[model samples]
Target: SRPWRRRLWDAVQAAVLDPTNGLPKELRAQIAGVAMAVMRECAAEQPDLEFIAEMNDHFAAALWR
Candidate 1:
């Protein structure tokens, strides 16, 4: 279960970061939501506030770019 969740997280990150994929804005927003949800879930389990903030910052920057 943990391995699968990690894989899902990795895949979401890759999709969000791929610049040439030409994903629609709506779809990208949905993907970003998923990524945030995953991060929140992981943070709940581990309580890594700094890592969570870093991930949120990175995600926001990617969204703007």
Candidate 2:
């Protein structure tokens, strides 16, 4: 398993948590929820590539909004 990936997740979670980061709480929550879901699928014994890709697309679209 790639431990650094988890560290990346930790960083995302931390950003959502830190109010000093300046992002609105609601937007942070929305993005973070998808990130956490991606982490869960990645941690699974058989990660779903399709789901991960779907989540990635969703994240990209979210960024544009």
Candidate 3:
């Protein structure tokens, strides 16, 4: 799954708190967009997910980034 949650959360935190973590400006702009896309895709694929639990899962998954 390309470590979607990790990548997503890392991207978000980077954009929020670290503006110059070695990433380029343009690529940084796409961070939030990509994160949202990944979260949406994951949610869609797992229709039976418990919303809060799954969301927590994603946050936990992000920690492994």
Q: What is the TM-score of each predicted model, taking all chains together?
A: 0.47, 0.65, 0.35
Could you give candidate 1's per-residue lDDT for residues 8-63 as a string of tens digits?
46677678767766888678777767676765666475656566556667766986
RMSD of each: 8.8, 2.6, 8.7
Task: Find the number of clashing residue pairs for candidate 3.
Answer: 0
- Which digits, one per residue and each the tens of the lDDT, describe model 3 over residues 32-62? 5555654565557453335534665765786
Q: Model 1 compared with the native: what TM-score?
A: 0.47
How does candidate 3 fare on TM-score? 0.35
List the candidate 3 regions with Cα displacement exceeding 4 Å: 1-17, 45-65
Best by TM-score: 2
Clashes (backbone N, CA, C under 3 Å), per candidate, total 0, 0, 0
Worst 10 residues of 3 by lDDT: 45-54
lDDT minimum window of 10 residues, candidate 2: 1-10
- Which one wins on lDDT? 2
lDDT (tens digit, per residue) of candidate 2 on 1-65: 64554565667778887878788889889868877887887788888878877866765686699
